[model samples]
Target: MAGGRQISENKKGLPRRWRFMHGAYFYSVPPGQECMWDGKKTFHLGRGLPEAFRKWAARMEQPGKIHTVSDLLERYLLEVIPKKAPKTQIENARHVRSLMAAFGSAHLYEIRPRDIYRYVDARSAKTAARREIEVLSHAFTKAIEWGLIDNHPFKGQIRLEGETPRDRYVEDWEVIEALSLSAPQKRGRRQGPAGLYQAEAPDRPFTWGYASPAAGCEFPGRWHSGAVS
Candidate 1:
């Protein structure tokens, strides 16, 4: 019975200026008004009805409202986030939501570098704030790419709390303890590694553990020479 109705019939009960087509919601640009829609005839909203409405609101609302940071974030989440890896999609969603809470209502052009620095300072979790700012910065970059904004506010902001480098020399006992905790075990035809291979250098032997075995699990060099026999 649903197939018998005209294409227009299925769009009934939908919001004004919205259409359902090709199994997804779309928005019709007013006649002779393609300039307002970036020269597109019809915008493919999305498959999900609730999400379609959200995108519709972002597009159909007042012109000023469409240029808000929140609108940009919504568009990014709708258009960019889905193409990412599954774990990345989840993390980016969390970051975007946090950005929304901070700068959602602000107009895109009105956000400045100082405001971003202030947001960074206010956050107790500096690491999380850095990640959120990275997402926001990329959102702004995409907004510029989309012609929604002319500039990015905080792309190169300094992150004070970075990951600790593993340059410190790891003690032999530390490596032994780590190996004790999760050493490889013999399985069927394959045997567990006899020992890790260290390079010929004696002064920096432990650093190899932090990096990689010089010869791999087979230990064909200094490790067999007397290091781990």
Candidate 2:
């Protein structure tokens, strides 16, 4: 009694439910069965895709289940968060906590796109809201895979407009000119040590610090203070 898109033939050249990325093979869980795989939305099957297919086939024979949005959140916090990168694990945990406050007690299928939009609109931090919704959307995706729900309510529909990136990034030529202007002055003060320091010294202080004696000079503080010439 599974719902949503039917399983189709693999036109992407790889096997059905299988994906290759960053030099590893991944198996997308069957809709409504992620709980069986300990809440992993996709199983990392290793670098060699062909051999990984056998592992995928064996895991596909078994299926598992879940209860509510909170149930999903718990499982994700327990099973999924530990597997992510250190920074991402912290971010996802915060996102999950925010989501739990809003949708924890609700049933998986009961969530709608409108509910998500309302959440987005109500949140004061648009960028943070967008990130939290991304986590929520991914949870719904896992819900569909685990067979907890037949359809994702807010997968691609909600758009939380975040702050734009600042346009005033420093140019490479500006950096080169700054370095050029500072170099001769440094050489004038300390001839031998300053001559050893290159234009790239300002970019990598710690590395250059151990590598060159000039790094011991007050150049680190002077450069950081934006004293060019």
Candidate 3:
């Protein structure tokens, strides 16, 4: 369901009114509802509109006040949690990037489950979808506090399972393969992601961004430490 926000009025010089979609709602004040200036409105996008979004539409439309998603997040960051922790800020930045990177920076009022899923899927492999979506939910929670918007889209939604953290340790071959592709070095007889070895450049940072169980360069396996590639 796409929630489209609209400014309804016969205001002169207006570009026929603006319409924007979020999810499961189509907002628009039928012409003549404009009291002084064009007023914005939100409404259910489909028959099976979520109760939450329906309620949101009712409140926002009964007294039309539309805000963009980014606008809401900004208010949430500074105005709502002025004293937010440094770690939290960092996480927010990371998660927010995943969201925007998944979806373009459109009017925030237009995000939908589709966009949300896209975000989750895009970063699901790298970072668990649970934390990624959770962080986004926190942003919406803050928005609620600031009265910018209600209803966290992630609520009641299925998230990646929360089990004991899983390990994505790559194998010797896998590691060498990835490393070879990313940080290509003197390709030797070695193959797989394992051949991804760098000459002992104790001076250089670990050539690989993440670690694998290989060449002893990896944890517990660190063997010939003389800069095992």
Candidate 4:
């Protein structure tokens, strides 16, 4: 074998009659089989095993036939998925399904940023689309590390949209009104300043924002300055 070596056992515990390997390329054959090989002609182990195995091994030895997006995804599922967290594995599986549905048939080298952009545009949720691309990007990065692909399609090509922060301001009067309107029983056991502050604190300020009022109101009871409780 030009790019392969022989082994006594297959991936399973069962004994393999003949196994061959060469430079990341290998195939198994039944015991005492004679196949023609000159390191130039196509390798063939005569009929007995699945036809796909024969075809795949033959293609694996050829430089031009290597690295399909589908194959990379399959490898990622097998090698990478197990190491991920349970929630992450579920998420990645969903992303992988989408990726395969779109680009599984394409070769890894053939996929471009434009194809990815199209996929992103087709998605309804921008956040979800961004996550999907991120997952695919990670898979492509793994492919590059594994030497399956020379470059990543997403590298420096895709830009995710930024999320804006929200700021809300609540006036002290609104909080006081809400507290006054709430029933005495709903205000809990205490009728003191502590109880009113405690009852109002959870329901109001945080929902809106808590800032000192421009013009403060006088409290009916003793209350600390700048403190809700």
Candidate 5:
């Protein structure tokens, strides 16, 4: 502070900036010695005046200027991915971990459109990869909302939409097959006995076989065959 005259307050009596930032909020240990909150915290400023403090702070305040892949990965998992189903979230977390293992230390700014495009292609080939891509896309979308990234790499990408077709639909031929009873013995309308079909007895399980086309079979033989009333 140099002990000079105290600067006057701003419009709201709050100084916009201070010379010596106070508070010893974090502790340090020897290198390679594990700290309880290592790799999961943001309190690493030390006693020396950093030459790149302004640049670093500016980047930190930037909407999505994460310096390492790990930072973005953690943020995406904790903030965005969990909003989906638990199964989906777990899968995305696994994919994100795999991606980081592949390139964890890479700087975020260093990742290019080509890199992301390659990622899309690679992740699109498998179910897990596709799900991971979806989650990654979601996180990137949020980053765009925060003014972090400019655009989504998965935009306009060709991928599966996860749908299964229904087989219940029957064509006209199928409906005819279902109602193929003979016309003479048909309980309902019969086309002059030509369309009449007789189902066999219940001797065998589901033994109701359709009558042969060449030689029509007897209908139960209990009364006049193929004769109504």
Candidate 6:
């Protein structure tokens, strides 16, 4: 206890158990537990500090074992991607690659909401950017569950643009007209407007019409032919 400075001499009014040393306050626990105070009113050296101290000590011993964004992405790709559908795997892989290119060198804990927002802003496609952030958010959640990181940077921060649903209705005649203009391909039988309309309207009666009037109309002005107005 030679180097143990007394708390009474300090004007800050900290408890006697707390001692200031090397510009930080440390609380001394019974049975030889010394925990560093984060100066935010939280005591890390109090109850259950031994386990935390042990983890800290272990981390100190290794030093280079800190997980980075690239590491998390690699683990996610290896462990989680295989469980998803083939199409989903491809899509998620693309998103992860984009994320890795940006923050792969940064530590998982160092990434913040601003960095994610920057990435979102850099992308030209709003929907694709949203999807990329969504994938990154899921990966960060998995990283939390895996004990790689403590929190998600993108949680509650990502805002995707609203998608407007198409309300235009396609009349039967418009579908017929559009299909009539489409020439059949030489290699295979083409699905005409009637055939396409039939395929799209199997679940509902055609009287109510299809919600997407532009489905059969490839021409620029064809969508207006069946306008509800």
| Top candidate by lDDT | 1
Task: Summarize candidate 6's per-residue lDDT along 3-120 as a digit string, tens digits.
Answer: 2332222213222344445444444544423233333332343222223233233322222354777777766665665455544555666677666666666767666554554454
**Prediction-by-prediction clash tally:** 0, 7, 26, 4, 8, 0
Off by over 4 Å in 3: 1-66, 80-82, 162-229
Model 1 weakest 10-residue run by lDDT: 202-211
Model 6 misplacement above 4 A:
1-66, 162-229
Task: Candidate 1: list runs displaced more than 4 Å.
Answer: 1-65, 157-229
Please list the Cα RMSD from the true structure of every candidate, rounded to 1 decimal place.
23.3, 23.2, 21.2, 26.4, 29.2, 24.1
Ranking according to lDDT, highest score first: 1, 2, 6, 4, 5, 3
lDDT of 4 by residue, 71-180 (tens): 77766655665455544555565666666665666667666554555455445565766666766777777776777777665455444444333254533422442343
What TM-score would every model get versus the actual structure? 0.44, 0.43, 0.36, 0.43, 0.36, 0.42
Candidate 3 overall Cα lDDT vs. reference? Answer: 0.38
Candidate 1's C-alpha lDDT?
Answer: 0.56
- RMSD, candidate 2, Å: 23.2
lDDT of 3 by residue, 82-188 (tens): 24343343445444444433332344445544444434333325354555565555656655555765554433333333335546543343343234332222232
- When summed lDDT is taken over every stretch of 10 residues in candidate 2, the lowest stretch is 2-11
lDDT of 5 by residue, 53-111 (tens): 32224223323556565667656654555354533443455576656653456554444
For each candidate, the alpha-carbon lDDT, in order, equals 0.56, 0.54, 0.38, 0.47, 0.39, 0.47
Clashing pairs in 5: 181-196, 181-197, 182-195, 182-196, 182-197, 183-195, 183-196, 184-193
Better by lDDT, candidate 5 or 4: 4
Model 4: how far residue 222 lies from native, Å:
71
**CA displacement after TM-score superposition, residue 163 of candidate 3 (Å):** 5.5
lDDT of 5 at 132: 52
| Candidate 3 TM-score, C-alpha based | 0.36
Off by over 4 Å in 4: 1-66, 162-229
Model 1 agreement with the true structure over 145-225: per-residue lDDT tens digits: 788866455443333344354455654423542343222221311331211222243332211111245754331111122
